[model samples]
Target: MSKKPFFLSIILFTIFLFLKGNLLAEETVKITLLYTNDIHGRMYPYENSIIAPETEKIGGFEYLSTLVHKEKQENPGRVILFDGGDIAQGTLYSNLTYGISMIDLMNKTGYDFSVIGNHDFDWGKEKLGHMISKAHFTFLSSNLVTKEQGEFIAGTRPYALKNIEDIRIGIIGLACTDTTVFGPESNISNYYIFSGEETLKFYIPILKEIHKADLIIVLSHLGYEEDVKLVSKVPGIDIIIGAHTHKVIEKPVLKDKTIIVQAGNYLAYLGKLEIEIDKSTKKIINHKGELITILNSQIEPDKEVKYILDKYREKYEAFGDTIIGETSTVLTKIPYKECTLGNLIADSIKITAGVDIGLINSGGLRDNIPVGPVTMEKIYRVYPFENMLISLDLSGKDIMEIIEQSFSGFHAILQVSGLKVKYDSSKPKNQRVIEIMVNNKPLDPKKIYRVATADFLALGGDGYNGFKKGKNLQNVMLIRDAIIKYFQEHSPVSGKIEGRLENSGKEK
Candidate 1:
């Protein structure tokens, strides 16, 4: 054998080894991300001894802990936990405990980061600030900023970068733009809410340039559609975990290179994503995702989280046990296509306002009233949202527009008081509102009218986004306060279902 041939063979073997080693070094790292949203401070299962009508209780901090632990165990060291937000208010417990309990629970549950939700600011900016300070995980928000008792306004951080297993992931938080409309005056009246798209535009370049993260993830409370729109306006976002629409997305919706996932509401589901990244090339190789249902039969509750939850449970019962009034007849809330309870409550607001008509968004009705003795507990359950009563002097044309918008869609099923409206559902959009009358009087299109409605509607609830554009807006009263006041004045009472619904110009 020639020595030249032997040398050539050695060189070929050495080159093969070098190329193989480079390929092995470029291998991707696997990361599993778990997400939840709109927990609404449900520390314990919905199975409270105080409230009746038994349904399978699914979510609680304890159960959530158990589920998250299982997820971690499944993925071992490659898991990341996140909550999209709304850990502030909703139930009797959050309202009574002032959100410290929930914060403690979130810290205990190992949430790595959470975006500031609209409800997080429900208790006001000071309280929200305190919650952020107390939280163990980073409270990531890119849009909300504080006015330092001066004229200057600053936007929140652009995004946060997390380095896990050689992969750099940037997480940005986007608060809902409807903060001005949904949140209380005290929480956001001073600080303005900028467009989510604008904030993202300002941040994306900075994150890419400064952080040099391989991937960008947006922790958004801007609802799914808004997130979809955002990805189109701003390029380069890899994933968007969204909330505020309460949509239980089974699969992540990918739009223009942005993958969006929302874990529904009330802690009923978890969003999961697995991403494989090439460390050497600094690129995402593959991604997989799914939504896991948190059913009662699936997992056991964590004892420590349960213990903390039990303490709040006791506190909740104590607060709700207060006797507000008695009902001679049962006032129950039935989850119908159109709710009778909603009609009654909305009528209460209209009566309180002494207005010609009143409307309440059915979405604002949180819980139900059982068919028995009425207590503060019952009232709280029936009308859970802390909504205020807002009045508007809308012209006849504005009222028609509002009605047309509501009736033409799945959302416009009216829970009204002191008015009868008849509309054709089959008519073209916005033309469906056929006839509207206040006290047997046909609606005057040119005349100004006083209307009472829940604050949620004033800010556009259930696709009625036009309410924000309504003229002469005035917060005449709060819906909850008005209801409480009505109970105080009326004492023990019962109400008959008035003829609120009537046939319009057409048949269904």
Candidate 2:
């Protein structure tokens, strides 16, 4: 063979190898996004009473850690772990530590990022700031700003950029605007939660054009409906990891071009979102998403995380185990109508405050008290919010207005004691109250009445504006403490609905 021909053949082979390598590098890439939302400080696996029977054990930080490790091992560098906020402030473990346990656990579990949930501020801004500082991962929220300072809360960013396998992924964080209203009024009064749509409008374009993100993922604490509406309106978000609503979305919802995934509250489910991105266009060509139930039997608990939880358990076991009292009947939470639990709580507030009437929002009741030994842990679970009892003086007319406001929204019905309310839901918005009786007598619009309620309502939580207008406002005691006191005085308590709220219209 001629030497020149041999050299030419060698050169051609080398060029072919180089071009093939480049082409291979430009092929489609697969990335996996693992997310959990609204964990609510369920550090230990327990029965999912809302969804499953008492025999079924599901969700816990230890089991979630096992899932996280398995996912990381399977996907390696291609997997990203995130939490959609409200991780703190639910169970006894969280309440004891003020969410320090959750932060420490998430750090150990290797979370990449998280959005700010409204409940994260339940303990107040200082506490939330401390947790943010302690977190190993980044906290992102573009819309939560301080009203007094006119700046973003310290230590949180609008968005984050991560380069995964040569693709730049921008993760934007949008906190729920309802945070200002739903959270502890005193805690968030200095903050302004901007609309999610408005925040996205300002940030999405910046992420795409300026940051040059190949993919945009929003870690949102906004509810499912809000997330859907946001994606529909904004149009640039590629994926949304949602929280706050606690809806178990078994599959990803696709709206326009955006993919929305939410793992239900309390670590009951873990969402896995797999996306195939075309290298040329940098757009998602194919995607698959599903929620994996965190059943304790199927997945082993992570020993390391379990050890930390055990330490916390040892510390708080005394208070958690202390029997508060006993209940003769199951005190259930009825959100739409009056229930035994609501009546009992309302009565407790009334008796404790020595007020003529007591009112509590249906939404404030978090759990039910079983007809057995009532422990402090159970009470904490039932009333987890840090709301205090407030005594206010309001005219009978104001009382009627508050009742009408509560009945305005089907789910906003007020739980009451010392009053009987008959409402026709068929009636128009402001005219729903048919008749209101105080102590079996017709309401006197001109007379002043003493009312007791949670401070949350006194501050106009859940859109109860009438409560904010009361005269001679007095903060009594913590609602939880008052309930505990009531339990002490009335052991073997019986909670029964006594026709306090009468809905005359067709049942919804």
Candidate 3:
């Protein structure tokens, strides 16, 4: 052949090889991200009444572990497991052990990382530090800063970088700023929380520019609305695993190429997000996500996790199994309205503290009491905060102000005893309380009355700032203990809503 033809052949061969290599590099890579949020220390399967009406056993660490392991077996190295936070401080197991049991379970189940939640600070800073030290997985939160030192909280990373099959995944964590207001105030008083948007703005560019991260994920303890806002404002995030609202997102929400997923509370569901990325461009070409219900009958329990859970159950069986009381009426929690269970709890506080009025935030009532029987375990699930009751001497004016503030926000509605309140939510805030009565008489501005409320309120949690002006502050007893005592004395108790709170407005 001629020299020109030979040269042309060599060039053609080089171009062919280059194009073939580019095709191979552009091939899509599939990654599966399995996540859980707001587990709240559910180590064993139990019937969750909130998720379903029937008494079918639902979520547990064992079932979650089985699902995770099976996913890993199917997908191999492409599977990554994570938790969204609120792992501690829900069940008797977590409360009794101070979160160690949950941490061990997370370790056994092979969690890659988790974010910090407000409830994780319930036991105090030192205990939170202890739990962080014990956790085998990394904890991430980019926005939490110390007050005195102006540094990130110890034992937490701002972000994490993981490499799987030539994919550089950057995971950033953001915690809720409400921790200072809703958590143990003293424990978090030394820290200041920054906004998630600011943190993302600072970190996303760094992850993309310096770290060369192919994909960015956020583990956020911010609620659903906040997560939606974050994705709308920030441009680089690919996925957000959200918690703190206890929302059951049946399907992942996608906005502007970002996916948000939350698996409700108490391990009722497991969230999974799968994405096929164009390796060359580091962009997701296709993705799908779903919330998988952790039904015990559908998924077999992991033997090792079940064994560990049994050990903890055996240790706390006596306290958890004790009969607290029985209720003739179903004490259900009605959000944004007066609930029968809330009435019972408020009544318990009034009787225990010998106060003229009892006030408790509705958010403190977490679960409904079944009519047939009640146990310490059931009560703990209802009132899991472990809040102590405090007796406060407040003038009728201050009490009225507190009630008005509660009516300002739907979630802040106060459960009450020894008093009646009628509000028109259509009216402007700070003026929503239409009428207030104490002991069947109009509230007197000057007269002082004894008020019993949780210490959380006395410290001005949930925007009950009027409680701060309370005088003669006295610690009465643990609110849970007081309720337990009331149940012991009032077995087969009748908890009913007798129109103590009436919304007279046209708006429902």
Candidate 4:
């Protein structure tokens, strides 16, 4: 071959290479975002309360693992997975290991990063440290900090900068500041959490300027409304994956310059967001999101994740399955109102403590008992907390204050025994409690009465401070133990809505 022709051929090949590189750079990039929030330690499948037929159950790490793996397989390197905290402390399996089991499962579930939720701190900072140490994914939180030093918890960073498919993505992490108010005193005392707006204000600049992030995704554990508020205050975010409210946002909400979506809670649904980013502007030009209800009937459980789940299950399932008692009526939890289940729990405490009154927060009571044999696992689902009983002497006036707090709309309304509480929902918060009759006698301010409640209330959990003024304080037995003992003695028991808590007024 002639030298001129060879050199000409070489120049044409170099031009082709340059053109191809530029064309690839200008082309749009597609990325699939997979997210779950507030798994709440649902290691196994259970009846889907929302879905019909009572037995069309959903959720479980096994089915979740299969769905997620399939998505990753379909998309390859374009898929990014994340969680929105609260991996532990809801079910028996999670409580067995104080969240380490869920962490272990998430490690296999292929999480990229997550933000801490209030419940994630329920076991306290020490146990949270263990979760952090065990998580294979990055823990990101811009707001969670030590009370004294104002530093992010060890093993957690303010945010993570990831380069996926040549796109620089920044994920800002924020936890619910209300954790300080709702979480247990011991768990919250060591840390101060910041609101999402302030945290985003501080970290957005760093991500934009320092890391040069092309896309900013906020993994927010703040409730849905709060996420909207944060977006209003600060701009520049492209996406927000939110949790904490357990609000099933079926569609992504588009605000100013961002889109917000939450998967709901308890591993019931996985949120998927498909977006096409402009190669030049680096903005999400097209996007669609949906919540995939994790129905075990539809998909085969991933074997690897199922093996891990089984390992944890075998360790705890045997004892959790022990039949404790039976219920003739369904003990349901009607939120923010007096419930039959609450009455049973409150009655258990009252009878166990031999006190004049027994009370439990409706917020503390979760799930309902079916009309059949009640197992230890069912009881754990209802009362998952480790709250112990506290016997305290309170003046009728102090007792009045506690009743007022229950209707104050801060926490769930109180469940009561030995007292008939009449409340008007239309009235203002503190004034909602219209009348209280102790043992059918009108509450007298001067009279002193022994009261039974959880130690969590005495410590001001759920913003209930009236229990703080209680005198003759004595710690009784674990509420869980009292419940079990009640079940053993009172099989085929029924908790009816006996008008212990009567609503005199209607909703405004």
Candidate 5:
């Protein structure tokens, strides 16, 4: 062969290899994950301290819909939308529709997948199935399964595989871990729910080996801390988007090379994550995530979604718009502490049941009752759950146990009425309640007392297991109705943080 020909061929081959290498390096695919959690049917205009620190109202579902649609339009086929759940029960509209309206909105907004939150099962398992049936997107839960064969529950799958461009994305959805405990207990026991770490450990390998997923995303309804703990246990997760704690994770948490992000609750923000994947390595080499504040002022509402909302507003306006009563001052919830709103609601439940003591879970009180017209809508927002009121007859010892659980801090302290409880939280668990006075007298261990609370607590929700000891449990009315009735009977009512609960341990 001629020397010129051999040298020319070598130069051409080097050029060809260089071109191929550059092409492989530039062949990265860009993927955007749009997510929202704990929207809680808060589709209406409301003031949020998160997005706007000022008095301005933030969030309208139409605005969220617009922002989501805009991303889809701008990105074309590279976008996926997921909600961390809690779409079922929050606002009057969502509750009235059995969450079908929210499903309709999600369908229109182009959600790809979502997991079921604990509150989603609030209506009942059957109702959750109905809501799932209505959704245009898939619901995934690796943990919740029928006791038989350990199969994923009906209407939900363990994981979903999507091929976007050259990358195969595998998403494992983990439902709310507290589903059983935060339940209308009778409705949630058939299926077995597992821990996030266990479930993720089982599925991560399947996704990586069998499916050859280029990236793994775990959409979790287990709160932020649990998500971090799960990441610590499960080695292969690329990202975890979580809910249930209603955390405003302003910055994405990177642990063990995995990213975790949660948008604040109540439609305050839409979560957006952008990732660049290397085709050759099939890895997310770079990623950026942010919560887009849904400022109603910035974007035009989606007309179709807005029309649906308007229709509901007009139809239900008469239902919630009627002036139920008035409040002389604002009644906001303060978790694990004595708050005016909790006191007011507890008082209402106590008086309505004609019981000696009233107790309520602080989580049951979602929003604050502002000073002015106390409309049914406001009450609905505050007492979002349809928890029925129940009266129980229990010995003073059982009452003391319940009081101790409140101070133990496993959950928010139970709000109380008609009793003055003093807890030394610094003391050992189950030994916190140092003193209790009922009706200006000390609690009698032998004396049976009448107690009123939402059936949720009576059924052992939020870990208040002491309610199990009570006898003579009788159903009162829907909790919201009791609150409304209280307002009606007392129209110009007011609430203040009266030291009904004294943490003597904290005084020092």
Candidate 6:
């Protein structure tokens, strides 16, 4: 009997010690989120100085893979890798292969979840569907809805839940509404994009009332400003990882209880977010954001990824090197002003569309075609936006108004073909077009005229709202395809300086 009492006492004391130790220990959980956005299909580091002279060779998938591996080593099982969006377009490789290479690279990198960017629809919904089906991670886009099956579309989720030890995190996604306005017709023609705020309002209750997630994260393709608007309107969001505008943020900007961060375009920077959450409440107690530059000199790429990249490179080089045509002089892209190359592209469009005049936005010109014998590569280098050639029939009065509105906010130099105009820079806004002509004939306000321009400018974007009001708009073909056809029909096109400027009325 005495031995039984002693044994019971020992058991009680052991239980007491165990409970006391656990109370004192109070283990803390820490998680690190590593992210990239606007990785514009740059599978390899930039090479060929003539093509990309100003920027250093950097941001290859090989280097990114190596960095991810190193970060994993440093944090063991507590690290998560993610991409915001825009992984589909912007390079020859992306354009040639229709985003397959980027999809393959992203799958290899093991992205946990991503939102659908506007460019993701470049190859249309079918290709995007295939990529989503093939992706190893979840693709989330809440605002995208479908009526095909009277339900949501394929390859998209409103949100994804991640459980790291005892902490529960809910990551939601929002794509930009402008995708409907600016994206290719095939991608978003059938869909309706709802306001991000409205979508979040419905989901916030679900996440909080039902799922009980500890932290809420938003994966948004909406630009930084839109994300800021989202934070201000929606309550309970903890963090937002943004893309679209390609704004490189060095640190997280706090708005009330929410934090916003964006890594710049072209995979040039990786955003690392380190967070400490309270064990009981699961709310963030501490957070830090760091933007890591993917500089060539600083990073040594992983050999495995490099080898795989080499294999893709070998396959791409064969088709990419095919000779097409030659350029007599260099064609460059200067965003603030019209360049000679910009004029050439606009001229080609005007000629192809059989329009009276042509205009192209400076932002549409992606790169410079170095002065030399032009090739297929050179054409691809100069006009990389892949915008379609849209011809619109406008009265001379409408054309003049467009020109005036274009020069409203900033100095917009028009690259013209088959047109002549004189401007006074000192003139007030919308009155700068001092003189206008069509094919050496003065413009008649009542006379109808045809004009050719890219689809991007026609939508009132790039500060060209005058185009949206124009009539008889017709989209004939893609800009690059038109250029290619132009060269094929009229080989050896000689450079022409169509002096459209005739009179300068009191220069600024």
Winner of 1 and 3 under lDDT = 3
**Number of backbone collisions per candidate:** 4, 0, 0, 0, 0, 3
lDDT for 263 in candidate 1 is 88
lDDT of 3 by residue, 71-116 (tens): 9999899998988888888878888998999998999999999999
Candidate 1, residues 304-361: lDDT per residue as tens digits? 8888888877867866777766656645453323355667677778889888788876
- Which pairs clash (backbone N, Cα, C closer than 3 Å) in model 3? none
Q: Mind giving the per-residue lDDT tens digits that candidate 2 earns over 292-396?
A: 888888888899999999999999989899998999999998888889999999999999999999999887787788889999988888888888899999999
State each model's C-alpha RMSD to the native. Answer: 6.3, 4.6, 5.0, 5.2, 4.4, 6.9
Q: Estimate each model's TM-score.
A: 0.80, 0.93, 0.93, 0.92, 0.93, 0.82
Give the clashing pairs for model 1.
388-479, 389-478, 389-479, 406-412
lDDT of each: 0.74, 0.88, 0.87, 0.85, 0.87, 0.77
| Model 4 / residue 81 / CA error / Å | 1.1
Q: Which portions of model 1 show Cα errors greater than 4 Å? A: 1-26, 47-55, 74-77, 146-156, 186-189, 323-337, 370-378, 390-398, 408-414, 444-450, 455-478, 484-508
Better-scoring candidate (lDDT), 1 or 4: 4
**Cand. 4 Cα-lDDT:** 0.85
Worst 10 residues of 5 by lDDT: 179-188
Question: Ten consecutive residues with minimal summed lDDT in candidate 3?
Answer: 179-188
lDDT accuracy of residue 456 in candidate 5: 88
For 164-225, candidate 4 gives per-residue lDDT tens digits of 77689999898778742455534666777677787788888999999899999999888888
Query: Ten residues in a row with the worst lDDT in model 6?
Result: 499-508
Candidate 6 C-alpha lDDT tens digits along 1-508: 4799899999999999999978744555778899899876767776545323465776788888878888888978878888988786777776677777787787777678889887787667787787788788888899878655544558688998898988888888897677533555444647767888998888877887799888889999989989999988999899999998788889999999999999887777778999888788778889999988777767888777777778777877766666666666655655534456666778889989998889876656656776555566556656656688999978888888877765564534556777777776567777777878788799998998888988877776555667787788898899998887776776565554455544355432
Off by over 4 Å in 2: 1-26
